[model samples]
Target: MAVIEYQHSAEDITPAQLNGFFVGWPNPPTPDVHLRLLRNSDAVMLAVDTETRQVVGFITAITDGVLAAYIPFLEVLPAYQHQGIGQTLVRRMLERLQDLYMIDLLCDTDIQSFYEPLGMYRAVGMCARNFARQSGQ
Candidate 1:
């Protein structure tokens, strides 16, 4: 197993280091836009492979800074999955939002178990996605 380092900031990250994420999205954001989103998010957690210096996983959240925060993204590179990186990313991001009144995210039913273990619960929610803007242009 390779050494994995978790970082709370995206300060020195580059597009090249962010390759291979957003695995199955038909219109995934380009690395440039990915970095831009990371920069714009209220908080982010990254799981980096120490040997390759690549960002293998990340979680991003947006917050009102007073009452609520929504986690919009959590992804792990295909090659790096099942190694606990995703769990670490989510846990760290949740901890960062622990003080907030509400911390929420929407995930598929299959993945709900993943968050349940981390203290998150299932809830009804609605979302609108503009496929054209899915790439976060």
Candidate 2:
């Protein structure tokens, strides 16, 4: 696979490049909505497949720009998982938010180790989910 081209901006990103994301999500957001979310976020990191020019992975965070930040999404296309792309995306986004006092994210228990190596520690957090909102419709 060709090396991914990483860009910090949401410009020039089309719906066609955003296919095949939301893996394992029963009610994942559509590409158009996904673009809206990214555009609305405080910061974003995109991993574009160099060969196909598709968006294979991405991470987004909303922040107060002073005290705290919350990562709302991180996704890597199934075909591109285990290739260190996810880790790199997270690391880069964290660096972007390093000036803040708190950076938080919610993820499956199994993925804890993935973030631990990137200087993130285990923490207890509470969350509420409205399953209906998963589609962002």
Candidate 3:
């Protein structure tokens, strides 16, 4: 299939096409929670299948719109991997957040190359997780 179109928010998005994401996660968020997180974020970029109108991938960031911002998530469904959809979503999302002074994200070393080409820099970071909160209440 040809690359899908991009949308800014959940305006026409449905949960049906949101499947196959969070691949390999031990505690992945549900589609409904995913929608909540995206909507709650300061910015979001979504890639939708043109013919099917399904969300194939998405990226989200929360920021103060000035000094700093943090990217909480970037995901492309399993079937859509290796097709540059992930990169496209990140490019669009970064564009939307270009005004922010410091844009940061925490990711595994294996995925560092993905962001390097998009103007992101590598940095040390710390994080904490309570698996019980993986699924929002």
The TM-score that candidate 2 achieves is: 0.96
Q: In lDDT terms, how accurate is model 1?
A: 0.92
Q: TM-score each candidate.
A: 0.97, 0.96, 0.92
- Candidate 1 clash pair list: none
RMSD of each: 0.8, 1.0, 1.3
Comparing 1 and 3 by lDDT, which wins? 1
Best by TM-score: 1
Q: Could you give candidate 3's per-residue lDDT for residues 25-105 as a string of tens digits?
A: 778878887777878888889888888777888898889877899998898877778888999889888888877789899
Which pairs, if any, clash in model 2? none
Q: List the candidate 2 regions with Cα displacement exceeding 4 Å.
A: none
lDDT of 1 by residue, 34-67 (tens): 9999989999999999999999999999999999
Residue pairs of candidate 3 with colliding backbone atoms? none
**Candidate 1: regions farther than 4 A off:** none
**In lDDT terms, how accurate is model 2?**
0.91
In terms of lDDT, which candidate is strongest? Answer: 1
